[model samples]
Target chain A: MDLWVTEYQTPSLGFSCKISETLRVEQTKYQHLAVVNTDQFGKMLLLDGMIQTTEVDEFVYHEMITMVAINSHPNPKNVLIIGGGDGGTLREVVHHPLVENGTLVEIDDRVIQASKDFFPQLSLSFNNPKANVIVDDGIKFVKQHKDKFDVVIIDSTEPVGPAIQLFSKEFYTDVYNCLKADGIIIAQSESPFFNKDVIKMAYSGINNVFNTTKLYLASIPTYPSGLWSFTIGSKKHDPEKVVFSGDLDLKYYTSAIHQAAFMLPNFVKNIIT
Target chain B: MDLWVTEYQTPSLGFSCKISETLRVEQTKYQHLAVVNTDQFGKMLLLDGMIQTTEVDEFVYHEMITMVAINSHPNPKNVLIIGGGDGGTLREVVHHPLVENGTLVEIDDRVIQASKDFFPQLSLSFNNPKANVIVDDGIKFVKQHKDKFDVVIIDSTEPVGPAIQLFSKEFYTDVYNCLKADGIIIAQSESPFFNKDVIKMAYSGINNVFNTTKLYLASIPTYPSGLWSFTIGSKKHDPEKVVFSGDLDLKYYTSAIHQAAFMLPNFVKNIIT
Candidate 1:
């Protein structure tokens, strides 16, 4: 018998990977979580039937979402990540030697526990001295904290249930308030090919709250449409013009890629503007 | 009952699309060809069970493959396309006012007939005065004509069956001799994620023949990895530095995109290097 795990990207589209074994499956407080070992992608993490990360292609998403914002900021000493309980985003954040503090706020502790159990490559960062792992609602946490972080990364899932508020303009306003004068916020905007409405909402929400807003793209094979987008909202810094001179060992994020990611295709650009 | 067309990208991975109807299916002299009207991607053309192009995202592949080579050369008048039986590449070639002659050499006549019967949006370019559609072996055609064309596009299917020779070094050397002194050649070099060996082979083959060779990327969701790569071999001009000033009504290719497409992520760059 053949075992395959399929993610229905749309009602008419699906992507599947052959699985070797089911590592773990549980109903978390927020969503359905599953960890599976696949023949092609190695260990995979899924939430609410959506792929969150895979061993083969996790670098593209983690590096792109975190490094672009971290490198763009001049002095990114303090960072806050929301909803990335898998610890991939936090792993990328702590790579920079200049970063003194990295805090991750996730609503569910079950995701963190699963990552610790199955995805040790990513969850190992939780033991770092600079890392601060918190179990709390990201929205409520942002409301209480004001002007503390140099970079705020909204690493939430799709804007369906728990993440609906994360894509709203009101939530962006709170995130903007929780950042320093020259802070930068980066969020995982959905695929431009599949989620035009979500992209437009995220871009517009960021645009309304920040002085400079930019949208960039990366190709994550496990994600919907294989093309994923990131939206950056900066209070003062321009991500495109920032000079990143760091020599962090990376597989996907580079200085050239940093600038190139912001150069959207005509159809993708039309989605936001 | 529901019907789905699945492309087994790898032995362990698959991408599927819901099909409304099977418009045509035939075993051509060279390969098996099929045209299906998909609910997500509109009409899709498949050769030997691999997607060649789809109506919804065809512009991304067609524009990226042809425009980069045409714009790189200072004066591209005569252009040759190999194995693009679907006529999408020809449509993009004819869009440029500078392309006085666009000759397409496809191995199978059945593909052209199928395109004309079903995908009229792409096959309509065959009627243009500048288009010279010929059903011939591209390898034979290139050997017969030396120093004839300004741009040569190898838009063949995956490196399999009849298209296998298209990725060989000897074939690239022959193509090198078929071009003018200031000529450029572009070929659809498979996915960086899935076809690393193929990318290396195509890149090294082109590099051996041309003074300058570069690999670039685009996202075609219907393709194997959603991230697709194209290899360019230039004699005298660098594609990255090309200033495309034409106002061709394109959906994907732009001057900014022309430069940005060449910016490969570190992992993809490591493949060819």
Candidate 2:
């Protein structure tokens, strides 16, 4: 009667939730996938023994990742999401009336299939007529497209497994070329508390290819260190200077929170800047 | 050879750390206490199956609790900490050049004993000549003192068992009366993400007593939701408007973060306000 599912956030730190039953499990070509019904978090999607999304706190991660860049662009029409297999980022993107077209490139097909089966609320956007879903490598896809997207959002996992190349300078340069002259990109950099080196690497890598770059903080409890960071790189648009007055009917993101997220703590400031 | 220690952040959600060994376990008169050697968090202290402090992220909790109020008051010579049995707040207060004296009144001597024995870095200020360490009930102690201290900090546990009275409206009034005419009080308000009702209770209780009350946030991974909040009540000083230009050789607190901490997201703003 006491069934628990655990994610080892670090080599030693583990987070467990009580589970009513395991919904599905499969071995994808790229990673292992599992879906479970948890007593606390509702439903959870895990990839390779790590928490990818939870029903309870996924709103915080999805909203923070999509809205900041979408709202910052003056006219966000063409939006691109890289490696968001769960479709949460795409779900938030298609909410914008101005986003006429949105595309998602996820390498793992099983991750998407699992989400579509178990997380219908998040996978709603996959059926939108304005959306295009691709099962391909994001690094190669971005390199082939030039000056296409107004906003590029990377919703990849930790810099491990098949997604390791997404953090490279070369891949960022490709993303820079794939965006419009005034486009913006937001990638989930790891935590400053647990992954200082990854934060430094992502900031430094994105800084080399963009005209303007900024790093922001958000609290995502399911992640390794609940304190998570994101790097925003823009060709011309300054995310910190942009403002939004329209109603997005959001649960977390706001114009005030957009500015406040950039104000990092002293130790985190030392790492990025 | 798999050993696990679990802390139920809520009744349904659990956080576990792989343990190499359990250092100490004993039942105090007030609550149960345990010290464990965790692979991820180094040494950790637990009270009544809840995490009190961990060596890895204790800096975030201690620094946020002590430095904000100390720097806000122009001349913080005298300070009082209620229920900080671990001496972490006392240690941070002693770092200020303007703090001439500090007092800590903790209910259980056993918690202090556990801290001194396991958490030496945090318990470094127990023997400070300017500090007065009293083992007594904090609610009774504050009621007997009037216009005595420049700052009063309540670092008690959650509103359970003996500490439930500390979060009541009557107790906050006593804390207000214990301070000087232009004094400030800061209490560890629970997370708005998980403990919404508790946060509401603490915020509304403090708001009734102080002319200016503000809520701020910090990220401590071991705590529930990883997004922890604090409420500050002041007679005249606005915690939002205070300026600090000195260096405390701190790892976390800065003037920029001091400002950002008060900038709540729209959802949290709706809750506290």
Candidate 3:
């Protein structure tokens, strides 16, 4: 089939690149990796049927996922990240003033190593002394820990292969157990477009345990759909209340955007509802 | 050569999809127009080498671009859109209660016709009686008109091709002339990641013509970097003061986001400074 590509830029998608040639694909222990350079977004990397990163914009995703959950929790003392081996999430999490301790539990040691070697800016979050890099299964770690975290951020890959367990009800239940009473958790639920069923399932699963469940949206160029959704589960504090009250120093998430992010499109809303 | 795809979710980039397909040569017009159906974003369309849209997530882009610019302008009586023939911008433009006349100047009638046929929800904006669809070059139209618009939104394609003139100094000057003293113009710049140079250039270009120039960011899934940037140029109004005081109820843009949208990143700040 002669496939034609079209890029929607109304809202102004950041990086738009069209690839014209075969670059290179590297099969990693965790996922198959591929590298392609396009005319728009620059160098992009794909892993195990999912996009990992490109040389273009990387700040939006990392900031929203970390800031929303961290900022929502008034006192984020200890932070646990599940499967953010890229360290980008960790980097943003450490920026929070209240976060004293941060732990990244990733299943693939290679992902972390690869990110550190290749994408240095993303891996920069690990430079902080408080960030504890744990090369262990995030699910296993969550099972052992109980009420130890004030905030938990799930930066898992797609709901396939090793990352599939992160979307399970049992895992989220454990995640609920692993947080403090007033804790908050943000999970990178797949693109609201392609992964509607998965997002709905995850939201339903997380909603079963949490007091409040909110879905936030972000646009990632590398993802299957430009529109990406993140589900934030809070226990005590409401997302609406954790307003952007501080110095107002943010590139992505502002008080207005925080509220807007919660406003899901009708289709996504229908799926989750 | 073998091509590899990788997706990265950055702070500026909400999400990205990388494709690593083997290729022989790159086409000029459709370098980014490779369509791929994935487990996530549905039938993805690429053009000239960037993501256009899938059946999903088009609302996010439309809502964001139109809402922000429309809400920013106070009492937008006569609105002028430079590009955006798909009618997504027009749809959002006419939503303003005070918007008495809305004119869309698009070079590609095909895009408008195609969108009206393929994406009905987006094209619905043009169906309104208030909308005046002008199938002509936006650059020439703006140049011919003087002090004719309250708000001018440049929803053109990328800075390349037919839309390239919209980003030039002369076009911005014409846009400045076409608006009233208190007029506002919002232009879609490139991603801050890959298109920072272009964004910087456009920033400098717009700033040359308008007094109060602000660079804001948005996330759309179908774009290259997923981290979209919009530059707003005002003759007299401050974008920070731009609010949704109008009676039109909006799903996205709000007073808070309007103020927050002007908050520039350190990198962006460095360039503007």
Model number with the top lDDT: 1
> Could you tell me which 10 consecutive residues in candidate 2 chain B have the lowest summed lDDT?
B240-249
RMSD of each: 0.8, 1.7, 7.0
**Chain B TM-score list for all models:** 0.98, 0.98, 0.82
How do the residues B1-273 of candidate 1 rate in per-residue lDDT, one tens digit apiece?
Answer: 999999999999989999999999989788888999999999998988988889999999999999989988878999999989889999999888899999999989999998899888899899899999999999999999999999999998888777899999989988999999999989999889999999999999999999999999999988887999999999999878865686776888888899999999999989987
What DockQ, between 0 and 1, does each candidate earn?
Answer: 0.88, 0.75, 0.18
Give the per-residue lDDT digits (tens) of candidate 3, residues B87-183: 7778887877878999998776666655665566678878699999988878789889999998888876676666677778988998999999889
lDDT of 2 by residue, B1-273 (tens): 978889999777888888988988999889999999898888999999999999988989999998888889987899999999998999998878889999999999999998999899989999998888999999999999999999999998999977889889999999999999999999998887888888898899999999998899998988998999999999988787655677777888877777788878777888976
Better of 1 and 3 by TM-score: 1
What is the lDDT for B221 in model 1? Answer: 89
In model 2, which regions exceed 4 Å deviation?
A: none
Each candidate: what lDDT?
0.92, 0.89, 0.71
Can you write out model 2's per-residue Cα lDDT over A1-273, one digit (the tens) per residue? 788898888877788888998999888888888999988788999988999899988988999998888888988999999999899999999988789999999998888888888899899989899899999999989999999999999999989976878899999999999999999989999888889998898999999999889999889888887888999998887798655568887878877778889988778889976
Q: Which 10-residue window in model 1 chain A sums to the lowest lDDT?
A: A240-249
TM-score for the B chain of model 1: 0.98
